[model samples]
Target chain A: MKNGRDPVIVGLADSALEGGRFVKQASVLGHCALVANEALKEAGLSMKDVDGLLTAGMWGVPGPGQLNTVTLGEYLGIMPMFVDGTNIGGSAFEAHVAHAAMALREGYCEVALIVYGSDQKSLRSRTLGGRPSVLNMQHETPYGMLTPVGGYAMAARRHMHEYGTKSEHLAEIAVAARKWAQLNPAATRQDDMSIDDVMDSMMISDPLHLLDCCLVTDGAGAIVMTTAERAKDLKTTPVSVKGYGESHSHWAISEMPDLAHLLPAAKAAKRAMEMAGVKHSDIDVTQIYDSFTITVLLSLEALGFCKPGEGGAFVSDGRIAPGGEFALNTSGGGLSALHPGMFGMFLLIEATRQLRGDCGARQVKGAETALVHGTGGTLSSGATVILQKGLQA
Target chain B: MSYDNPLPVIDQDSAPYWEAARQGRLDIPLCADCGKHHFYPRTVCPHCFSDKLSFDTVSGRGTVHSFTISRRPAGPGFADEVPYVVALIDLQEGPRMMSRIETDDVESVQIGSSVEVIFVRATDEVTFPYFKLT
Candidate 1:
């Protein structure tokens, strides 16, 4: 039984996605500086205040080993007490948040700066070389089952087969996300769209339309975490790390025992809630990773937000839409918002903003407790973090 | 770009499975120590981590655990084969295999539905296994 830790999100920052300002190259280290500088500015601190640095592996750069954590730390001129470069797919950012929280609780470091950035869209093509690994690439890629969209499409197909989930049910999730994006000025997809329109759009993978998939954008996001006691003296309100949990079912979708159920996410969510000592009803907002529409539905069901296989029905009732009972993805999520490869940092930043009542038009009413879920590697791994407005040291 | 002549590279780890596929037989490694079967063709059993393993031919009969219809082409070479079905078939012999689902209508394929193995020769060097509704 792990108790709660008081790691506060003292600073949050992200570079502009429009006009290609901060990110024009494929270097992960360059984007790290952009996001880290913004976060320091927001905290009224400098790079000298950071003692720890964590980064995700750069995908856009060529060669096997281009960007790593130690190299990133050396370039940033910050000699930290701890350094991490754990890549568990896109959810690496959420894992970094959990790592920072645990390090703070154990008194490993005073301030941990977690950063993730990518130029996948501008520099690298979406297509990747097929490497034979026992986990994902070897199992399904041989028969033309490559790419994340295909992997997620396979999961969506299984859900439809078991529960009779229609394409419209999946489209409703996209519709809701686009609606939220319309309210956000920074959202990439601001155009209004209907469920039918989403269904009629270009089909990338059967059961998953183009709208169902997330955008691949060149962007970067960063967050600075400190102990709860030190957070009080910071510039912004501290959103305490109430609870967190993580689990991995397998490394690939083929190794997943059951496609209709997300066991790891369910187990992680249950443990997170138990540690936070809060129920589903206590959560005023949620920021689930929306790499695909099916991901949100599966995560919603796995997190106990709704009954199993009822995730398709839950979103259809407009519950997760803007101005609905429960606010979700106020930043428009990865679907409509900018997807910077490892987009989990954006989820944490949005959750912190929502809990602090900073989302002017997309804010949830009186949000006290919030939940954020991050899924990585074809739903193979997941991490859940719970946040609250105030906490006692 | 001409989307043709995509070759399957064989490494030491997957050489056995590829050789078996060329012989028109589906093979999986069964560990004698742990008495368990595993997929993706590994030298050591994932359960007990023992290298003492033997290859065995299965009945090639199983049920569809789950499947997905890929609307997008897998790569430049597979652009013509869009809207193909990829499935995870649970073999009766205890190992699950990942293969393409060969059925006219993907809608009719149900979970736990019966299926059997069929091999297709993709190139001279490699032959792949596929599953079809029985």
Candidate 2:
């Protein structure tokens, strides 16, 4: 916390997933309000206290001319000082946190709320059937390579070819995650599974098993941020934003120059460490996105937590399991956890909980420092944030 | 077999890929100045950003860099084609292309297996490029 710029996350909340009420329970506008209200309640603040609102681009919904800040402010009867709608795939939430922090540091906003809620799992058939307008669908969707799984499959295929990575190794990641899910009450897939189970599961795309992909969930999450000076008086213990980094390698997987190396994550991780003045070993827990098991493996290598091409081996050896050298995705990750619209917020929530010692069975002991990484758009973009306790500015 | 539907559409950016498919050739964009080859058929050279590029028809010959036997069909259009192989073939000329394994069974598509390009006409405007075990 230096430079009078430390921003602290003071409040967080997520919606429940009961009654199969994914998308229909609340209109898209209502869903945003529902989660936003929960977050405000947790922070002991009224909507009038908010000065900024940030939201991810709605995945399957119509665009709101006014970004989330404007729309939410319009509903809450308060004008926001700043509004941001920077969309970067699942990592949108992480990117929003970084953007809000910068905005606060620049004295643009005294308080900011970053939120994401989606009804992807509950969308009508029409919304799910057509090509997304925001995507470069014209170029990549044809030839039956239209889905996210297809893009990640190509990446996994190349990784296997170049490094001799085994399918069993990928299965190891799914099996381990499922095992962790058994202890997570909120996990969607809590049944016992083994490597063979993953290998035997139906394949969605080549090299991408059904278990390898993330769950389609309907939920929303919000994070409240304020300057460190203001966060001291807040009800909750503030989780300080120690360091952050972000980079976009390409707009599409086909545009990525090297599948063997996830350069963006590497560069972003380096900058994050530099900004935090901490090393990789100092991190007690990590919540890297798991859109696919390969994502986690690749991120481990890119983040310098493990060597290149050793991701497969590193994960298979139980290095990321609970009580291992480093704990990863203790909330079961998107693979087994509920994946709201923007999965990145779930990573942030898990990281914050771990640093605050909120996770019950999956908590890493004495977890003082946490790393959260999010991958967006077919590994085309990535963002990393470091969080620590007692560092509030 | 069930009733057939119209083939998937191929846009301008990917049109050349389909054109090369019909000729039973695997063509990649090669930078004339840099002598570098790239995939996904971009008009400009990724390395030098030179628009001076040409479609170089290479020997469909390549080693299976990595491959996966998809047990489930990717889409309704491919439901009958379950347990198929999709592979990333590393061309000897330097480029990786995603194509299906043109084999009777999945077991035939193995890592490092030698493959040759083949074409299956999908419609008037779309033709899929596939690889067969050599």
Q: lDDT per residue, candidate 1, B3-118, as tens digits? A: 26244567776778778988999888889999888886788898899999888788889998776676766667677776778788899988777788887786787778899999
Looking at model 2, the pairs that clash are: A161-B65
On a 0 to 1 DockQ scale, where is model 2?
0.27
Q: What would the per-residue lDDT of candidate 1 be over residues A1-393, giving only the tens digit for each residue?
A: 132447888888887777332434436567778789889778777899898788785553465335577677877887889877777777777778788888888888888999887776776545632444343355566777656777788789889887888889888888888888888777877878898898888977776888898887878888998887777677887788878888888765678877878898888888888988989999999999999999999999999989888888888877788977768888888888778666788899899988888988888879989999998888888889999886544
Q: What DockQ does every candidate get? A: 0.49, 0.27
Tell me what TM-score chain B of candidate 1 gets against the true chain B: 0.89
Off by over 4 Å in 2: A19-24, A60-79, A124-140, A157-164, B1-28, B54-60
lDDT per residue as tens, model 2, A126-241? 12123432223433333344356766776787788778888788877777777677777777778788787888877777778887877777777888888887876778777888
Each candidate: how many clashes?
Answer: 2, 1
Candidate that scores best on lDDT: 1
- lDDT (0-100) at residue A301 of candidate 1? 91
Task: Say which candidate scores most in DockQ.
Answer: 1
Query: After superposing the true interface residues, what Cα RMSD does each candidate give?
Result: 3.2, 4.7
